[model samples]
Target: MGTDVQVLYFGILREMYVQAREEHFSLASGATVADLVERIGERHPPFVPIRERIRIAVNEEFAASGHVLSSGDTVALIPPIAGGSDRYCVVTDEPLRIDPLVDAVAGPGQGAVVAFVGTVRDENEGHEVTELRYEAYSAMALRALNSVIDRCEQSARGARVAVSHRIGELQVGDAAVVLAASAPHRAEAFAAARMCIELLKQEVPIWKRETSPDGAEWLGMRP
Candidate 1:
C-alpha cells in the first residue's frame, strides 16, 4: 500500500487527532508503518497513546504496526470505542414542558413551529448505560451553538429560537438536548431547527462520556 492514505482515528482517537491533525507531516516516499507513527508523534505528542491502545488498519484491513506503507495506501488509526448516549439528550432546565424543552418557542400568529428534544436512552448499541457525562469546551461549544441559533433566526426572520444541552453527568430521563424554532410558518421553523441541529453536531466541541454496567467510556473528544 502507498504511504499517503487517509487516516481516520475516530472513537477514542480524537484526543490524538486533535493534537496531530494540527501539524504538518512529511514522509519519505516509501516510509514504513513505524516511520509514519513516529512522524505523527514528532508532530503531535498526544499520539504517544497509539503505542499502547491504538489499532492500525491499512486499506480497511487490520495491520500490524510494522506494516509497510506505500503511496496511495489508506492508513487508519482506530482507537477504542468510548460509549455513546442512548439517545439525544435535549433540555432546558428552567421550565417544564410536556412536549420537551423545544416547546419554548411559541407565537400566536406563527403558522409553523418546530422543536427537537433529545432524550437519554437506557442503552446504547446493546450496552446498558447508567448515566452520561457531557464535557464542553464552553467557549467553543457555546459559540457554535449560538451560531446555529443565529442562523436559524436569520433564515426565518420572525422566528424565535432556543437551544440548550446538558453538561456533566446525567442519569436516564434527564434532558440532554433541546432545539426550538418558531417562524411565520411551520416549514421554515422545522427546516431551521433541523439545520441548526445538524450544524451543532458537526461543529460543536462538546464531548459525551457514557458510564455503563460494564465500565465508563468517553464518547467523543473531551472538550
Candidate 2:
C-alpha cells in the first residue's frame, strides 16, 4: 500500500513547482523523509543538485532525515533562515507601507535605521512588463517571514526588524515589499536590513508572475 502525503514548497522550491504550493504524492508505506526527497528529486531534476542543503519539516516541526512519514503528513522543504524586534512580519492584500514599519522597528536607543523597498519593475528580460501578480501561501509565508526576522534579530544582537509583503495584482512602480531594521549602530542596522531582504527572497513562500505583451510567466528562483 502507499501513503499519501502533502508536500509544501517555499522560496526556490515554490518557483520550481510553479503549478501549486501544495502537492499530493504517494510513497511506499513506511517511507522516510529521505525517500520522499529522493522521489521529489527524481520528478524535479533541479532538486537533485541541492538535495543536501534542503531542510525538511513535518507537521510544522523540523524533521530529521530518517523521520518516518505517514499518510496525510504535511511536509515542508525549508531552504534556510538567513537572517528582527517589535519584529513584524506580515503578508497582506493591502498596499505596503514603509513609514509604519520603520517606526515599528525603531527604538529610542537605536541610532540607525535602514529600510529596503522592493517595487514592481516595468521591464524584465527584454519584456515590457505591464504588471505583476504576487501570490503566497499566507500561513506559511507569515511563518517564514517571521523566521527571517528572528534570524535578523539574532544576527544583529538585539536589532529590531519589521517586514511587510504585498500580494495580488500590482502595477509597475508599486511597492511589493518593505523591510526595516534598527540597531544601536549603522553597521548592524545595514547588515540586518540586507540579510532580512536576501533571506526573505530566498526563503519566503511568495511567488510572482510577470504579465507582459508577450503573456505571463513566473519568475524562476534566484541563483
Give the alpha carbon lDDT tens digit for every residue of 3-110 in model 1: 455555433344434433223344676677778778766656766764555556566555776777776676655443222111112221222232432334665777
Over 4 Å off, model 2: 1-85, 221-223
* lDDT (Cα) of model 1: 0.62
**Which 10 successive residues of model 1 have the least lDDT summed?**
84-93
Error of 2 at 25 (Å): 44
Model 2 per-residue lDDT tens digits across residues 84-194: 112356576656668767866787899999999999889887779999999998768877888888888889776888887988999999999998999999999999999
* Model 2 lDDT at residue 105: 78
TM-scores of the models, in the order given: 0.51, 0.61
What is the overall TM-score of model 2 with all chains considered together?
0.61
Best by lDDT: 2
